[model samples]
Target: MSFLFLAVIFTIFTIFTYFKRVFQYWNKKQLPNLQPQIPFGNCPNFAKGKENLGVELAHLYAQIKKEGWKHSGIYIFAFPTYMPVHLDNIKNVVENDFEHFCDRMVGGNPKTEPLHAHLLNLKGTQWRDMRTKLRPSFTAGKTKMMFDIIKQCQDCLVKKVENLGSVEVVELCKNFTTDVIGSCAFGLDCKSMENEISPFKIYGRRALPTTTLSRLKLTFFSNFPRLGSFLNIRTIDKDVHDFFMNLAHEVIEYREKNGNTRHDFIQSLIEIKKSGSLTVEDIAAQTFVFFLAGFETSALLMTWTLYELAKNLEIQERLRDEICDVLEKFDGKISYQSLQEMKYFDQVMNETMRKFPPVPFVNRVCTKDYKMPNEDTIIEKGTAVVIPILGIHRDADYYPDPEKFDPGRFSEENKKKMHSCAYIPFGKGPRSCIGMRLGLLQAKVGLCGLVRNFRFTLNEKTPDVMGLNPGSLFSSPVEEIWLNVEKCL
Candidate 1:
């Protein structure tokens, strides 16, 4: 044989041998796992949008649970991923043994991408410090302070809905949330509902990796962080980054020069900056993440809640009655206190989140070696752990008749009976969503405004059985949820 041909044969044999050993990692550790395909492993082709990451994880979860395993392992490409199945195991990973798995598996070079320094992507002490500084901003008192701003945005939504008669609720919800976050986070009047092409709305869409190429880049960057950093890869688009950074600077400059102090998040961030612990970039990064997380997740929650209410008219009417009764108690005004008084409304929102969690999976990277609770298996340091939030929420064992949209599942009595970790729509533990209270408040205000003023029914355009969007990361519907709205008599 020629020398070149011999070299090619050797390379092929070596590559095959390497992958063969790589695929046996889970089995060698004595963990149950599904057979993984070469190159893609057990994960779907996210680049081609073949399946959603959440759906794939949920399916893997179902398979493992069916086999009666407490925990199992899978692969994201050649990388072995640990998945905790039982509620106890999940609690240990997220709460009890949190120190061993404190950092998320998020990939980004903060030095290269300054915005990546935000709380969601930061690790260890950075995250702890940032969380401490931002905690007061999301406290009940602070959230209440921003209530009027949110209500003002809701008024815009109600007016827009009244004029439209029929609407794609997902888009409408996104617009409303965009305005709320814009006003609260950046201290800017977004007016997303009034504008045909709001800049915030436009850039917000660009921020997410919705397109095929962007998703591929995200997958590659996350899977190979060292190499991505070496190449100076940035997941955020340059233009989008510039827009937000410039906007942040503008807001800070205007506020400082005019001696203006607002009751919103940016003002809180400014206080941190004055202490010399934060910079303009730091402020921008935080507010950007605040906008991204606040708007998208809250919008999805509102969208799903409205869709469910539209589908179940009886439940819808009951929730509407609760809203009316609560507002009447508060002298016909929707206050933060009034929203808290709407018990049925809270139940309905909880049920909606259980059925369709905004972010279906929570990821944590093992920072230290840890043994599984009550098991012989040891998760080595640097292992990736995935807590399947969707899987847990929809488990028949935890919630009987998982497919049903019954708000009663979240009643005070029923919730007490459930495992604390079983229904974590916003996740659990210290690393859980920091802005959860604010996000919930945002959704509640928008939902209450709609449910009180308008009656919704599923339009012919909406699919009878909603399917998750494979192209998007969040648990969004495959198609826009169109609703027919009529003014409540």
Candidate 2:
């Protein structure tokens, strides 16, 4: 009698879940799309982590675009979601109608997920206030103040590359950027350039290790957030959570008690703490995010940039010349002012970001009911809106010869000819990355330092095309980016 009752309950529950999810999409009469399965929706491939979201979404976009649909429907497990494919609609979702669609569709309860308060997870008023306060901290003055830190680390990097001589430095560029961010962001001077177990490197690895177990769990929860929520699924590991929380607390406390102040990110957080308006958990959460954001995202950007440069020698030599000319004015030191003088450096960075945005994909939530531009269709409230940044960036309509690595595509004149919203590696509208200025500063400083000193070539082992690590949220290499570098001077 007990076993029979349990089976009956399971059958009823399964039927209800199917009705709410699987059958709902069928009744909606939504835009045409690939058929969804009972549980995974149109993302069985994504659920298996078999392909990257960017590539997967781009493939979907291509198919929908071919169908002549400017906008299409997708399912995050039978929850009808909006995917903007046309230029006008995508622009409206991000820019013109931003107020109606301001929040990125990231979900986390603040009390349960304290670390989620970090800028990436923050929304609306909280995001605005924190962003305003933090914006000035990344100004040219702040970036310049951190110049010595990057140079010191870059010197370490160059020496490490010099030691490698003719041999390949697998994942060399990523480590170089890691060292740069460590010194600049955390006040931790690390030789990730040479040392495998540098504390900063170890901590970064711990922050997002991309284990098989973690990936599977994340896919399940992200696809079925409501179900996962009810089941008490937690993506952040207890050990990782504790390590970051304790480290952040200790760092902040030591700096406050010792009467120490450096113009780095931690120092800024220290000021926020001293203000007494915010809690210690708030400070620790932001610091943890700063460290993670500073290292992984910027490292991947630099790695992709270096790999592209390796394959394009003419462009590489041109950029190296620009670096030389700019540094010559600053007595051969790469200063903030000197870096700014290299307009070509800005072009190269911009083009690199276009080809390989750190966050290749992003989501926005529709705040109010909104109409798809030029179409009669309305996007109902509570729909998850996905913007395929990587797809639009690589589209041949926007970029001529889309596969070509051409920094000249971003020259001032060429930029003037392009649409204002065409390039969005830092994203767009009011809710874009608050840390954009600092993120760009760190990436440019490291790239400039590398271009000024080393001549890099594609190693025999360099992947034909950069591959994404399946388990990461950010675009990361599945394998290390190997390169052969020689001292230029």
Candidate 3:
């Protein structure tokens, strides 16, 4: 009798396990995603690199559009994610119902990591408050205060390359930018350009996890963030965390005691602290992000820009002429006004960003459950929204001859003629990058200075095309992007 009872219990457990997935649902009244299985969902096969995120999402978007759906559903693990297939829906999701999708899904626990609640993780009210406080830090007038500081870093960058005497590697660009950002962001004179393993480079390299498994786990956490509470995923490593936190505190304290007002990002954060609106952790997190977040992105942008200019000498010489012309007016200093007037240089950067956006995709979570704007579909709460940025930018419909490196696509008139939402290198909407203006300014100056002083050529070791290196979640060149540099006439 006991055996019979046990058999019955086993049967019930099996039935319940099988049927519970029936409760796992989507509004099939509208466009449903390609059906997912018991657990892994649409992306399970992606682990062994069966596909990259951008390729998979772009394929789904194309299928949904072809099927006449304005929006569609997909899955990350067992959870549903809304894949916007129409431009109107894209505008609404990123702009109109923005409050419902303000959070960037990639958040860390502020309790454990008070420094983790920088702009990227701050949700709703917290994000709004911080955004309001930080906006003035990047204003044109405010950025101008740091113009001399930028030139100082630029000089250091040129000296490092000149000393190298035609080095072939592009990681050197990253090392240089790390030094520039280290000095600019935290008032710490990071001599990374002078020394390959400079403290900044050592910590920064360690901060970015160096394994494919770690990258996949980080993405999984972002997709199913609730599970992240139980996992050890972090936006930054511990030593990196300690280094910046202590540095921020010291910098803030020193500035306060000395009455030193440098009019930098940290200065604004100090004011927020004085007003009792932000915590010590908040300031540290923002500053840390300013280094980690902005540093690598700017590095890759400059690296690719240099690579493209090397491949296209006509474009490079034209850009050099403009830089010289503009600097001739400013007594050879790459000033804020001069940087702004670099129209061709700006186009080259824009075209480069379109070719390779550092963060290939943008993710958002549905705060409140949302319905498709003009459809019967309803994307439940806890759904991930993937704006496949690089995919969209590379779409042939949006950009004819998308493979060609054409800076004219971003020419003032040509840019106006295209769809406003089609190109968003910095992203679109309120949750967009707050440090964008500063980043672009730095990128323009860095590229212009190099183009004006040197001519770049693809080195013998460089690949025909940049292969997508596995384990890099960021859009990066697979091999060393080696370029030959010669001092210009």
Highest TM-score against the true fold, candidate: 1
Q: In order, what lDDT does every prediction score?
A: 0.89, 0.73, 0.75
For model 3, the superposed segments whose C-alpha errors exceed 4 Å read: 1-29, 35-40, 50-52, 66-68, 163-165, 230-235
Q: What would the per-residue lDDT of candidate 1 be over residues 1-489, giving only the tens digit for each residue?
A: 699999999998998887789999999899989888876778756424777788888988999999999889999877899999989989998899999999986656778778778998898999999999999889999999999999999999898898667899999999999999999999989889889688888998899888877776776776677888899888998999889989999999999999999999999999889999899999999999999888999999999999998999999999988888878888999999999888888899999999999999989989999977667888999888899999899999988999999999999999999999989988899999999999999999999989999999989998879988889888988888999999998
The local lDDT score (0 to 100) that residue 482 gets in candidate 3 is: 74
Candidate 3 to native Cα RMSD, angstroms:
3.8
lDDT of 3: 0.75
Candidate with maximal lDDT? 1
> Can you tell me which runs of candidate 2 are displaced by over 4 Å?
1-29, 37-39, 77-79, 166-170, 219-231
Candidate 3 per-residue C-alpha lDDT over 26-138 given as tens digits, one digit per residue, 9 for 90 to 100:
54445555666545566665445655565566666667767776676777655567777677777777898887788788756666666777888888898898889888878
The model with the greater lDDT, 1 or 3, is 1
Lowest-lDDT window of 10 residues in candidate 2? 162-171
Candidate 2 global lDDT = 0.73
Clashing pairs in 1: none
- Compute the lDDT of residue 4 as modeled in candidate 3: 98
Order the numbered candidates by lDDT, best leading. 1, 3, 2
